[model samples]
Target: MDILLSICAFILAILGIAGCIVPVLPGTLLSYGGLLCSYFASYSQMSTSALWIWLAVCIAVSLADYFLPAWMTRRFGGSRAGSIGATIGIFVGFFAGPVGIILGPFVGAVIGELVNDRSDFAKALVVGFGSFLSFFVGTGIKLIVAVGILVHVVADIWVHVVADIWPAFWNWLTNLF
Candidate 1:
């Protein structure tokens, strides 16, 4: 039962990493869930207080993930339409590869600006650049947070699991010899 729970936690952690890149998944939150699973599976390893702290961190990161892109777009002089387009592009680009993912927001922003104001190519380009920068920035933040959670998971496993087993295994081997 412990092993199964551990496996489930590991899978969720992996999915969290993937979520960081995918945009559709709640990367940090899923990673947080993995942490929760690990705690429940091995209650001796981590305290409830520790789990609560991690939960707060995860929630903060998730909330930031939602706002950062839009905030950045506005900071870069992108209009509301540009922000909306970038959002739509993100979902659409998910179907495409990495290249599409990067370009989708940019193209969408430009087109959105163009549609909103047909006479201003320069403005459209500027808005598109802002939208593109926002996407990358958001992606970077999510990646960092997700990776941090995964690292925590690994460290917990090492401390609570391997540390417990290594000595026992060594003792068994010595006795056998």
Candidate 2:
């Protein structure tokens, strides 16, 4: 049962990592959940403060990741159409694969602009550009935070595991020097 729980935790961690890049998933939160679960499995062995800190960080990072992109797009002159297109592109790109990821936002913008007015390509492009720029920036920020959060989770787990098994030692079998 313990091993099963640990395996479940690892699976959640993997999902969290994927969530970081895919946009549809809350990578930070999911990753943090993994850490929490691991601690839960070994509750008697880990400190409570560490878990609490991680939980707080996870919540904060996820909140930032969620809000920053929308704020950035609005600040950069993106219109409702541009925002919608960018969101659509994000989902559409998921189906289209890597190349589609790059083009999805642009395609969404063009279509959005065309829908509003055929001759307003220039305006739409501008809005689309803002959306693209904001989204790109937002995703980058999100990725960084996600990586940071995951790293912290991993490190915390390592320290916890090591502490739990303190005094256990193995003779070095390899001489790298």
Query: Against the true structure, whose TM-score is highest?
Result: 1
lDDT of each: 0.76, 0.63
Could you give candidate 1's per-residue lDDT for residues 1-177 as a string of tens digits? 655566667788889988887877888888888887787775447777877887887787777766665566566677787777777777787788887888888887777777788888898888888878877777787788778877777776756456555566678899999
State the lDDT of candidate 2 residue by residue for 1-177, as single tens digits: 444445556667878877877767887677777776667775435577867776787777677655553454455555666566666776787789766765677667656656666776677777667656655665666566556655654554555445543323222223332
Cα error, residue 23 of model 2, in Å, equals: 3.2
Cα deviation of 82 in candidate 1 (Å)? 1.3
- Backbone clash tally for model 2? 0
TM-score of each: 0.81, 0.67
- Supply candidate 1's per-residue lDDT for 116: 80
Clashing pairs in 2: none
